[model samples]
Target: MSILADVGAFALKLVLILALVGAIVTLVARGARSRGDDQPAPLEIRALHEQLRERAERIRLETASPAQRKALRKTLKRKRKDEDKAPGGQKERPRAFVLDFEGDLRASAVSALREEISALLLVAGSGDEIVLRLESPGGMVHGYGLAASQLARIGKRGIRLTVTVDKVAASGGYMMACVADRIVAAPFAVIGSIGVVMQMPNFHRLLKRKEIDFELLTAGEHKRTLTLFGENSDAARSKALEELEDTHTLFKDFIRDHRPQLDVDTVANGEHWFGTRAAELKLVDELMTSDDYLMQRMETHDLFGVRLRQPRPLMQRLAERVSMAVQRVREAALLRA
Candidate 1:
């Protein structure tokens, strides 16, 4: 009888262990299924849609007095189903929209800008317009030039584009704002500085003093005008200067074609000025903040803050979490051991 009791106890313990393991496996499988369905939408995206809806609902409910609530209910009830649809079965066009560039100058921003332009064109008709709120100290010449090109795409589509500078738009930053149909600015917003520059440091003298020599070979006469460790030549310097001048000329021409009214010579002096001064020089159309422009349009048209789709995968998030958990477990086991 004691032997039989021991056997039963062992069987019960095994069943209990199996049950716990099965529960854990089932939970992991269900969790995996759920995570698979919830594909990660975007990386570093502001939860704008969820936020807007929640905020609006809170405001509607919390601020309403009894009388106001009754009136709101009546109004809401009176709202027709047809009102939700756009005129003539078409989507209702937004009255005014925003194009905000609150990031630093980089190739990534240029890609986002390109996507934003595509989205704008999708929603905005030929008669529609855009207000680009630009703020940047500047960035790489090629990168910002590409970003500027994205803005130009809007104008090419026959859509009027307005640029408002509130913080600053210097060098390549100015290159982008200048492409707008009309440029506006706040009184103190930094504007202008139309120029191009390139810098390369040569440490050949230091290297020679240290008795360290380096050899570089190239096929083209202008393949490498400047080097980090090689001696620089007068001819190379002259060639570099010539190239810079040509690039500056192209920049001036681009501005000239866009704003024919401005004297490229005057604005191309690589000097930045305040908004009021810029307006005097016709660098800006008017002195107005983008906020004012948006507020004025809000009553007449719907406003939207445009942004690019987030680009992150669920697998990445899951892998990161799993790796973190594994590391923690390993660390804890190591501590015990």
Candidate 2:
């Protein structure tokens, strides 16, 4: 089986990744990008309020009967206001800021996530909320550790952070989620794998059969733990395992610090658990999809999604218009593009 294929408890993770993908598509539709508009603003951030309202209207018109549509149009024309009022006739509305993180082996979203977090912190004060719509199956340790540090900045600023995982947030992904004030996962979403793993295919045997020699040189005694083309030594394998166990300890300590209620020893086995089992193990705080969480918050909070986007250059855009159409279509099913 491919290393990426599941053979254990992870097989039980019936991840509703499609829901996460839909939320991400909505996030992109409401993000800081335009379609060939070339506004010269370098970047633009659209308020999700207007986008959501527009989408809602589109949905209503498409799904409602003619008489219902007429009634809806009339209501839209009328001036509307929040029903909740403060003591002095002011509206008491809490703000909800959203950001999306679609992770890969390299944790590619870290840069954009940092910028979005910075932007949100500039205007978001106390009583505000930030939700990260996140999905990642874990990745390189350093990449995710840095990504987790970016989220840590949000906590240091005293902002409430809610990380919603509609799919999988395992390994390094869980490292980032542990820093959140709340973690919400959909049923059957994959979680945990609160440990370290490393693997590589050794081609030394093949090379030997072909009468080829592979040399690996390292100054430090344990710098090169394993090699793809060189024979592996017992000392090297032992060192590699030792390092992984050490990282596992660090991983457990980090989660324990954030979620003291969790019995780290019981769950930190490089084994992923389905969302229901995760909540039972205290790996996630709640069992609900990201869309459900956001919709519930939208009623009282001014729910907005922040995305730090870079505009494509003219030449690149031209080339992309030629090539990216196929690529985009291919990646449509991915959680993020």
Candidate 3:
């Protein structure tokens, strides 16, 4: 009788757990269906000016005396009234739209970036500025190339574009950064690597030792310059090197065309520098963080942050959550061990 009671209790708990999981999954599925394939992702816009003002007001409330706060409120009220009374066109302040691109090896953020730029270009005029806080350590050549082209669109429209890097913007990242009218970086930010690199490991010798065979066939003479599983001939290696040099030359030409002041030959050596050194080398225009530049611009411009939020499928979200949970469990087990 005691054994039977214990088994019954375990079964009850299992049923409850299963029921809870079922409910959660049903809710997630409903959410996914509601945001079906036909619906477009939403555009999220944030008024940086109002956000900064609220933050400052909060700090002032904690640090300032009552009299000081009262005076500040009155000053703000008077300024608002004056602006309200100003002439229609004269009261319009120049706008600054902010976009953030946190890139990976594929420059995947370009998906959202292209959308954000298109939306901004619709309303942004010559008087408006676009501030892109770009952070990328570099990635695939074609991916970053597309991103650089998107930034070029702003310049073509006669709108000012500013790129700010607080961390690293080497290799292909610098490719995108150079398209901006102004490039700003933090004091210690890594900048520049105006060269191309390609590397792969050959397993031909290992396969030979293991008595394995690998074959690659191509119609064109130079179609396959190098291969991982096949023996590489001297001519193939030379051709690969020649291709890399060609890419490097193109990279240098792009930089020279954009920033003619810099001697491209001197700095296109696959080396990176901190922001200050980069400024001296003319790799970057200024040594300032994105935050500082935006704050200063906010004084004269109405700043806004723009983003496009795409919803993921229910299964994808669940899979990501499960992965995170598994990682946490492994970490906890390691700590216990």
Candidate 4:
């Protein structure tokens, strides 16, 4: 009877372990499957006004006296009553939708930017404005070009678009900034690198030295103008230069069309400048950080920070919790040992 009871207990433990393993496997598989879905995540909009007010209230509570806090509350109440009694009965204030784009080499943030913009366009009017706090050192031509085009959509709809750069907006970053109706930057922000650049290291010589052969085949004459593994001819090099020149020309034209006052020739020489110089050169309209600009706007306009967040799948969330639980168990065992 004792042996049978021990066997039963061991079998039950094995069954429970198998069930947990099977559940984890199922969850991991579902998480992987969900990743391939093309549905975009929902946009998350945060009211900057409320956030600022809450922060101020916290500070006041910590430092201000009870009488001061009471007086402030009364002031706010009276102000709200006055607004409610106004001509239109609490007139709607102009809104300023804020977005942040921290770019990478591929401008991956553009995916979220596009979604945020699309959501805003549905509700935003001409009186309302879109403020983009852009930070990028610039990258690929096509990537930033698409990002710039997305910004242009706001203006096309007659909505005001303002871009603020607190750090840098060089090359492709400047490309997107130029699309804004107004460009604001901090005093020491790096701005402007209106140029096209292409570079790659060729292994042809290295392969030759290593006694290795590499072959490249193409159908079109310019299909493979420059390649990593093949010997580059002068013709190919010249063709590549021509392509670069054409892209640069397009970039210049785009900037000129948006900022007619800019001397595209002077600034499009692959040179960057501080915000002070950039303002003088007409590359930027104002020398102000995003924080200052947004705060100023917050007084007269309702500012909302817009973002799109992809929620983790249920299975993914469960997996993460399970991983954390396992980590805790391991730590517990280590401590006991």
Per-residue accuracy of model 3 over 270-301 as CA lDDT, tens digit each: 99999999999999999999999999999899
Alpha-carbon local distance difference test for all models:
0.76, 0.81, 0.89, 0.89
Per-residue C-alpha lDDT of model 4 across residues 1-337, encoded as one tens digit per residue? 6655655565566557756976877888778778867765767889998799778877876687887888877777787688678896556999999999999999988988998998899999989999999999999999999999999999999999999999999999999999999999999999998888899999999999999999888898989899999999999999999999999999999999999989999999999999999999999999998999999999999999898986655667666766776666556545544
Better of 1 and 3 by lDDT: 3
Ten contiguous residues with the weakest lDDT in model 3 = 328-337
Clashes of 2: 0
Select the stronger candidate by TM-score from 1 and 4.
4
lDDT of 2 by residue, 1-337 (tens): 4422432223223223434544565567555446635653333465676688789888987798998998887776562442323257675678989888999999977977877787788988888999999999989888999989898888899999999999999999999999999999999999988877789999999999999998888897887889999999999999999998888888888888888988989998889999999999899999999988988888888887777776544445544553654454345424232
Clashing pairs in 4: none
Each model's total of backbone clashes? 0, 0, 0, 0
Query: Of the candidates shown, which would achieve the greatest TM-score relative to the real structure?
Result: 3
What TM-score would you give candidate 2 relative to the actual structure? 0.75
lDDT of model 2 at residue 38?
A: 60
| Candidate 4 deviation (Cα RMSD) | 6.7
Model 3 regions lying over 4 Å from their true place? 1-35, 67-89, 312-316, 327-337
